[model samples]
Target: MSETTAEKIPVTVLTGYLGAGKTTLLNRILSENHGKKYAVIVNEFGEIGIDNDLIIGADEEVFEMNNGCICCTVRGDLVRILDGLMKRKGKFDAIIVETTGLADPAPVAQTFFVDEDVQNNARLDAVVTVADAKWLSDRLKDAPEAKNQIAFADVIVLNKTDLVTPPELAEVEGRIRAINPYAKLHRTQRCQVALSDVLERGAFDLDRILELEPEFLAADEHDHDHEHCHDENCTHEHHHHDHDHHHDHDHGHGHGMKHYHDEDMQSLSLHSDKPLDPNKFMPWLQQLVATEGQKILRSKGILAFSGDDDRYVFQGVHMMLEGDHQRAWKEGEPRQSRLVFIGRELPEQTIRDGFERCIAA
Candidate 1:
């Protein structure tokens, strides 16, 4: 069966800093009234294990890079476990991987994109981070893993809000927005957010981008320098041309938002009214991911293919990319491409110019 026809199971990664109430949240999710069955993968059978029938213990293999990031080295184990789960199909509707507090989310998220078997069998639903409302701010400043978790999240549950005053809560939220403005934020006492907010969120699905950001395809209305070219091998010339487009960096978190200056983490947007030539776009995109995958946390785009009415949508975590043609352009809808990159110190200029080179002449 083709990828389009496959039964892609949705996998949600649950992560947080140590003592951030991830286990509490897991217990709630398992004991809820929701009728769906879920296979829970955890670092271990906790002191008080969750009362789920399909609980699996992970090996907690962590890989450390030269840059001091600790990523999960459990791809092989995950592949084996998921393959086994497939044998018991109809026994569960979804799978949840609850990472160790110190685990980096990139590798976990990347597994769904990089592995052929995993990709064929499952789709990443979302990276849901359950943050300790009282300690998140400190963790953001002290822990790279904590920062990465926030940066990579599609939905953030700010747990233990009752422990902090309103002023402290606002401050913590500001800090989170500074690091990641795109993730949906929910305040809770014991990870009590509605299941609908976290499950089946289609974070990596291109067809759902518009629903998440209604102004996703609008023309660029802001004036800013869009010049980009950094690769030593990049021969593409930069040109200043006004296009019907806008790049959004502000995510509606108004004044008094703390200006966080994490040199390794930030988000950027690129937009163009010109349709892209697949011949130019594909190879360039592959090369981009191949060389810069380590630094890229999450990447997503919706493109207008040259001479085609169908919209092309793609998203990736690290080097893994998944995309396909969605529906055709609606009558009177603008045919444009919008791309968003959330990661650590992305080469904004080079990416912007490279994408410009893919424009159909």
Candidate 2:
């Protein structure tokens, strides 16, 4: 019999570019009596403080005790805060993590899977990305975070739709579709979508996930090893970045306060020691392309091709994906499949699962 793991509770991560209406949507979710309790987490009270009046004035029940909604100064504080929330398991039915406009989401997600304390308590539900329809395309032209936010989302919300003309809306939607094909897109104005529509959508599932990826099944057959999977107190912190620090570092284009303005191309590398099936994995890839393709500066990876000794190499632009053989697993060489995603703070897990769906259970 194959070894199976226990199911973990899900928490949603909400992200978007600066002034993209994330707080408005969050306020709406907090007010909705959707029959589920939500514990809100964010960078700081002051960051989203501007929208407090709107959030508090909304009809939903408001609870702002001294430290209930998890907020932190540094990115590293997320794990400890999430651990605190898990202790009160019955107090809230779910958790909602809101990232600052300047924030990157990769490190936030790494906390869930990499940290023992966090992984033991909470599971990632889904990544919901909000976009300012009126200004997103212009922002992505020079902002890497904007693209990353879109590429990583399981659900994409095109907020401020009313501000854009029909042609502008169509152009932005087309751009979003090219970058991420798998994420569900929500069109709204002033974050006016139903809270139930975004939060209660039931986007993540473990059992159903097995049915989605075939590559994992085969990869599971082989003994795999990874440096980050150990039980020791995880100290490695995944930093959410807005630019490709590789060649652009010397140019000093995306550092400090300017980080939010860096429009350079970015990429992320995803690796798994496990083999995966192609059938289940295709949806995530398609979703990525359809939702955030235009913002995608670049993407490429080696996937385990089913029934063939050769590995598959997939490359794509905004909504366009092309793949062919890269190389075959060599004797004594690592057979692990790895994919590098270079776009703005694209959620690694969503992209990880895109290929993860290919894993055969």
Q: Lowest lDDT 10-mer window, candidate 2? A: 218-227
Q: How accurate is candidate 1 locally (lDDT)?
A: 0.74
lDDT for each candidate structure: 0.74, 0.57
Question: Among these predicted structures, which one has the highest lDDT?
Answer: 1
Which residue window of length 10 is worst by lDDT in model 1?
Answer: 238-247
Relative to the unseen true structure, what is the C-alpha lDDT of residue 5 in candidate 2, on a scale of 0 to 100? 62
lDDT of 2 by residue, 1-361 (tens): 2322644556888899989988888877876667766777765565443332221111111222232212211234666666666566677777788877766565565455345666566666677899999999887777867877877675778999889876677667646644543356778888887675567444333323322122111111111101112211211112112112321343332212112323344345565656767666677777776676544544555677556577666654344455666566567764556554546546655665566566667
Which tens-of-lDDT digit does each residue in 117-227 have in candidate 1? 887888888999999999998998889999999989988899999999876886787577556656777889988889998899988777797666532222212121111
Count of clashes in candidate 1: 5
Predicted structure 2: lDDT? 0.57
Best by TM-score: 1
Every model's TM-score: 0.82, 0.54
